[model samples]
Target chain A: MANSNTQADFRTRLQDWIPKLVLSPSLAAMLVFVYGFIAFTVYLSFTGSKMLPKYDWIGFENYARLWGLSHWWTAITNLGIFAFLYITICTIIGLGLAIFLDQKIRGEGMLRPIYLYPMALSFIVTGTAWKWIMDPGIGIENTMHLWGWESFEFGWIKDRDMAIYTVVIAAVWQTSGFVMAMFLAGLRGIDNEILKAAQIDGASNWNLYRRIVIPLLRPAFLSAFVILSHLAVKSYDLIIALTGGGPGRATELPATFMYSYTFTRNSMGIGAASAVIMLMTIAAIMTPYLYAELKEKA
Target chain B: MSVATQDTAVSTGRVTRTFIYLLLILFALFYLMPLFVMVANSLKPLPEITGGNMMALPQDWTIEPWLQAWSSAQIGVEPTGLKPYFLNSVLMVVPAVAISTVLGALNGYVLTKWRFRGDSILFGLMLFSCFIPFQIVLIPMAMILGKLGLAGSIPGLVLVHVVYGVGFTTLYYRNYYAAFPTELVRAAMIDGAGFFRIFWRIMLPVSGPITVVSVIWQFTNIWNDFLFGASFGGQSQPMTVALNNLVQSSTGVKEYNVHFAGAILAALPTLLVYIVAGRYFVRGLMAGSVKG
Candidate 1:
């Protein structure tokens, strides 16, 4: 009887541990892959690691050099422009389309997917299509010339000054539809009674949106801002495919900068430093939003 | 007075509605222009695209570009076309998706059903991993892959994707399973169902919707990933990298039609998924961005 009782207790204890055992693999992977790798990269940034990772500590030297490089400055400046325009234009176009579609329109199901199919595509595919369309010799400009508008010019893809804007245009085209969907979901979630009450109180359609609707979409807006900003910081494949960070380093963002430095230029320390700065930038934006979101749920 | 106001509002609304429809259609056309251009150009002969008007329909339609892009286009000195790389993508994506999704489902099951101390904090740590710029991990990941003898190979790429992708799949499953009633799990336990048994018999049986969302999300992302493919895919590059090579290769004359055909081929799988399961796709997108 005592032996049987002890066996039953052991089984029960084993059952209790099965869940944790099941979860341990993923936890271990995350610890080593995510946090451990991050720690390794952070450590590499402070060392004199070049061509390959070395152990000699060089303390802030890489970061100071990174900040001093004109290429790095250009990359940062281009990101500021790209992110600003991409965010603003996407918000405007997205909010407008969402509002317009929200009004009891016909053929919404058909139209919503059209706005969104681009998001399903690879950025490389997007870059390829846009690169062809934006080419000065054979694309829109050529087509316009064939249509007897001989003076029409759309060579932004090849232009040094305007190359970054081309990136913005492609990014916007790919992502704005997603932003619209988020807003539409938010718009749908708003209580109809609130809108009805506002209408009865003599709120015009314009005022109704500007006051009640837009304000209520604060969460969606915040989500869009955070998601887009982070995406902007991490923009790599798109720029590589579209511009190749080219026309003489005109369109380089930090992502491409980091890649070139680490792999091509033999400056792993500087590349790691640049990558760390990029992380800090994203964290600065994400930390607060995630905190509030997780805290509220908790 | 109310009737008069209602009449005026309806009349103005009709005009505004017309304007709104016009704008929506125009925007739709704008959004669709690139797809149209790609399809039309891919069907046209090379000379037609370069010499003739781009907006015009093909004077002589041809499937030569598609055949070439599929079978014989030069992607970095190999005239092997996109077939091998497409296969590489398939092999990489399937296992990566399967492993990540299974691990995520188990992780979600534990976090929600088998609640323990400091679970939320652990969950938070995993959640934040999803948002970090992957550049931070690139150098170390490359080193690690090299150390493990998996560098520049499909398995290496798969492992990389799985590591980054698990965070997302976990988020999806955890949020989904949270709303699932724990009472079912509890009852199963009382009935002598083991942890795996309850998960398999009870939890998974009802996990169809979230599974679809998770699978579709993982499929699209892994299929479309370029950074990892470019960084780690040396000899066995995926379709996107192959396509980039085919387009950017400057040795020969720019074959726009071939490039278009290749681009379309790269896009077809995800496009088909979007067309078929777009509702779930949107849900996944929303769920990913807006935290529960």
Candidate 2:
């Protein structure tokens, strides 16, 4: 009787502790998988880790090698070019679309979905479709030539110098709809009486938008810019799908470089260094915005 | 301040209306052009699709590509079909989204209403995790997964995705709940409701829009994933990986029609969601951005 009672008491305690115990697996997962992996990457970058995880530490050598590599330099320059152009163009285009779409026009609902449909399609689909559409011999250029406009030059995707911009175009298509939706929401939230009052002062359309509407949409722009910048930095699958970071690495971004280094070349240490560098770069860009946002919310 | 003001207001409104309409029509076309091209390409034969006249209607329209895509191109097993891949993607995505959202909501609730001593530190850690790129940890993660004997399994992929997904979903829920009034929680507590009961009875009921949003976003993200599938999932891969192999093989004489059809097949779910629940998706996006 005493033994049975002790067993029952133990069972009761186990059942009571089950809920708290359940959290242990996930907590362990976060520690071992998430935190552990991050720390491992940092440590690996300091070691001469090749295809496999190495224990021997060769401190700062990988960083020095990464700094000296031409491919890394190209990637950095391409990232700068890609980020600058893509972010700037996407923000401008997105803001314009949003401002235009905010007019409470007819068929606004129908048009909104149509614009956002690109987000539905994978970048692979877009890349393949666009590649065919931009093919010099078989695409729009050829078709136009058949229609008598022989002088048209629409081969951007195939061109090394202009290939990255093709990605910019496709990305703009994918995200501008999202930006419009955000801006439209912001616009709708604005008090209608403010616009009416502005109109009463004989403010022209351009003038009112330039002064009143633009300033009011600053929050939306900031939000869109941050998201776009993030997309730009973390770009990989899209670049791979669209150009394979090629026409000889002209379209390479840090993400793709890291991927190639780790997976293809098996340079784990250099790859980790690249990842750390990219992470730092993204942190630098995002930290200020995050702080401002938190402060504003507070 | 009366008559002149009224006249000026009417004139400016008219001008603005005209300008808005013109810009809308133009921008709408710009957005729709690529999609139109893709649709038009999907309808044509390989020869015509690759031949010329990208902006023109196909000289002869056929459903051959679609048929082939559904059958041979997308079909999983040689004898069976694309149904397996579709089911596989569904299985992976549904569980992933569901688990992540539930965990995210719990995390949010715990952080917001039931603050512990180290709550801020935990929340900060979650936030920090979002900035940690996948590239940074891919090798180590792979190694860990290998050690756990889950290197190339659906559950393993789901597990990795969930770990990555939680950060974003937590952010979403935390922001959403923060924006919500706290009086409800207090009211529930006063009415003798415990934490879990209040969450289930009160918070979950009102969290419908966010739940839908989270599900939709998560579904798309997991469904369309490529890199993880390529690295971890391998031969037991999802549709996207298979689709990549299908396209990448054979350099000469591009199979444009089949490729287009494959693209369409791959995009069907997310596209369907966006088309059907587009308003909700937009609402979710706006909410997400504003909170950020």
Candidate 3:
């Protein structure tokens, strides 16, 4: 009896320990890899690391150099344009598509995939395909000429001033459908009786959508903005494949700038600084969004 | 009041409906243009392409570009095409997806059913990882990978993705498991089923929906990733990197058809996933945004 009691006590302890054991790997990994790396990057930003990691402390010099660079200025401005246009255009197209589909159209399954398929692809693939379509010699411009519209010219990929807009076009193409899906979900989730009530009240379609439908899609709109803004700030592969951040740095974003400085230009310190700035920018967008998310869960 | 006004309103409604269909078709066309161009151009030879005809069916049907993109296209000094990089992406994605999914399941089981103190704060921190730009961790991650002697390797890329991707995966599973009935778990425990036993037998058997969500989500993300693939995959770059290199290789002559083929080839897996399990794909995306 004594031996069996000791064995049962041991089993209870093991049961209690199992959850922690399963949970520890992920917790330790997050602490070390996520939080610990974040701290390490902050420290590196203050150091004079160049072409390699260095421990020599030189505080704020890298930040000063980073802010002073013209290329960094270009990246920041391009981000403003890209983020604004990407978020706004995707929202408009997505919202419009969602509303149109909400009208109970036929062949919805077929049409939904057509819009959603692009979001399934990698940006590199999107960029490469778009680059081909936007190529001056063999792309849309040439096709337009072949179609007898010789006045048409769509060479934004090769044009310095208009290159960023090309990035915007490709991004919107890839993600607007995703935004559409979100809005559609939100629209579907809405109570159908409200829409019916509006109809019975003799509200016109235009006023009905604007007053009730659009306002109720607020959560979808917020998600769309947050997701689009996040994608814009982190965009790198698309720029690399489409413009490589140029026709002379016209579409340079902080994400791309961080890469070139760290790996290509051999300036780790400034690269870290740029990364920190990008994090801060994302954090500004993310904190409240996260708060809302957690609060809702709570 | 009865006839003229009603006729006018009905005619206006018909016109508005026609306008709506036309607008939707036009938008769909715009959404599909690049993909159409890619497929159309990939099937045609260089001559048909350079003749300034993009939207037309191939006058000269050729699979040479597809073959070339798969086997002969140059990426850097190697003319060995995207095959190796495609394999590398598969290699990285499989392990990362499997590992992250399993870990997420464990984390979810613990966070919900086991519920120790401070688990929400721990999860909140993990949730924050999902929003962070990979740029912030690039430098330190590079160092850590080097210290572990996995830098620039496929495994290094896998480690990076798994560590970062676990956050999203955990969110998926946690939200899912939170809704799971605790009665079954308690019953299993009373029957002397241990943690792993209950998870493996009872919980996992019923996790089909969230598993689909988790696996498909991780697969697409790890497969489609470029920044980590570019930054860390080095000589063992993923398909996206190889595709970019193939498109921009700038050899003696530019091969537009080959670029189209390569791009389509690179996108095919995720495209197939969306096709086969599209409902689950949408569910995952919706769940990601709403729950996360």
Candidate 4:
């Protein structure tokens, strides 16, 4: 009876702690590694820490220094440029592809997969391929030269002024497919009768799509736009793989800058401050868009 | 079926059809062109890859690069290859996807069908968690993992993936469950089926489409990931990390062929998943549960 009771007590203890064991293991891992580090970094940002997490509580000094840093300002500016240009160009390309494919043409399925395959591939691959393709000495320009056209100058990638545009091109390739998928979903979900009625009214293809289709695809457009912008804001991998904020921080975005500061430079305070600012900027930028989108859906 | 209607349909639609086909073909070529260059170049020798036009087919076809990429050049060692890292990727991604999807489905079941207090709040928290950048939480998460002595282990990486994955998986499952009729759940409950029983007997069986979505999404992310694998996995890297070390940060003699082969190797799993699950992927998204 005593042994049975002891065994029962052990089982009860195991049962009682199982949830904690299971849930806390993962949660605690994330809370410490992810959330805990974030909090630690934020706290470190407020202190006079450098090289590592040392604390002296030098309130707002890190933020002020970060703001004063020209590279920091440049990174912020570059992020804005990237976010705007990338979002616009990708949206246009994606919408165009989606609309073109929505016509129920032959090979629609094949075309859809072709468009989306890049999204499946890593940004590293995309960046490598683009880098090689955009190389002035070896790629398209050289090909043109071998073909006896020596005047071709596709040197945007090497040029500091045009390097960001190359990144944009790669970005468009990687993301437009996702947007296309969203648009296609919206297109298929629309009522066929509306198109039939429009056709009966003698609407041309351009007019029908422009006036009827595009308007009805507002929900999809909104969703695609928000998602793309979010991605654009978080885009560090592509930038790193392609340029590494190359040609003297000319292509620097906030994420890479924060990474360099936090890890490479060992400037924990500034890094944390930059991270906080990035979070705030993203929140400020996205909250209104999300609200508008959700309101439309509601 | 009428002659006149057929003629009109043919005439009007033919122009549009031709235009659409032309555009699609062009876009398809544009999309395939770079991938084609990568693979075609990989087939060529290093000299040929560098010397010839990127568009050119390999004059001297060789499988040496593929062999090399599979063996020495893949992992840090110059002999063994990427077999271990590939196994690591599989080990982490499988459990990550399985756990996240199962938990997500459970959360969705409870939130959508069950009349529970604080359900909306829980759901909202899950949704909002998606927007929090990993950079914000990466440090703390890493520190915590280190504290727990799990910072450098595969199980630790799997746990991290599950935590991050929960938000996305929940969204996926919630979107799916919301589109489903509530009457089914109500009927099941009125029949005196307990929560776990209903989820197992009814919900799980019906969750085919969304399950595919969750599985594919989680698997792809976990597989293609570089940041999590690089940071959390440490010396024991996933395929992407090893691939990144090989291809991204290269040394003096750039073997373009090997790099291309490595890229192909790295992309194989996600590409295969996308191709296989492409139809259902679109179907799940078009199920129109996640409007935003």
Give each candidate's interface RMSD in Å: 3.4, 4.1, 4.6, 4.3
- lDDT for model 1 comes to 0.90
Going through the candidates in order, their DockQ values are 0.55, 0.39, 0.52, 0.35
* Candidate 4 lDDT tens digits, B134-246: 66665556667788898878898898888888878877887788777889877986776656777788878888888888888888888887767877887567887776677
lDDT of 2 by residue, B66-156 (tens): 7776666633334233455656677778888888888878777666766546655555657667766678779888887798888888888
Give the share of true interchain contacts found in each model: 0.69, 0.45, 0.76, 0.40
* Residue lDDT tens for model 3, B1-292: 2232223221236677778778888888988888888998899888888775888989888999999999998888999988998999888889999999999999988988888888888889998998899999998888888889998898899899999999988888888887788898999899999999999998898778888888888899989999998878887899998998888887778889998999999999999988899897567555543431
Q: If both were scored by lDDT, which would come out higher, candidate 2 or candidate 3?
A: 3
TM-score chain B for all models: 0.93, 0.86, 0.91, 0.90
lDDT, residue A237, model 1: 91
TM-score of each: 0.97, 0.89, 0.95, 0.89
Alpha-carbon DockQ of candidate 3: 0.52
Q: List the lowest-lDDT window of 10 residues for candidate 2 chain A.
A: A15-24
Residue A40 shift from truth in candidate 3, angstroms: 0.6
What's the TM-score of chain A alone for every prediction?
0.98, 0.87, 0.97, 0.85
Candidate 1 lDDT over residue span B1-292, tens digit each: 3333233231236778999999999989889999999999999999899898777778898999999999999999989989999999999999999999999999999999999999988888898999999999999899999999999898999999899999888888888888788898888888888898888898898777788788888999999999999999988788899999999998979999999999999999989988888886566545433341
Q: For each predicted model, how many residue pairs clash, with residues at least 3 apart or on different chains? A: 0, 3, 0, 13
For model 1, how does the per-residue alpha-carbon lDDT over A80-140 read when each residue is reduced to its tens digit?
9999999999999999999988876779989999999999999999999999888998889
Candidate 4: count the clashes: 13
Q: Name the candidate that leads on DockQ.
A: 1
Q: What is residue A49's positional error in candidate 4, in angstroms?
A: 2.7
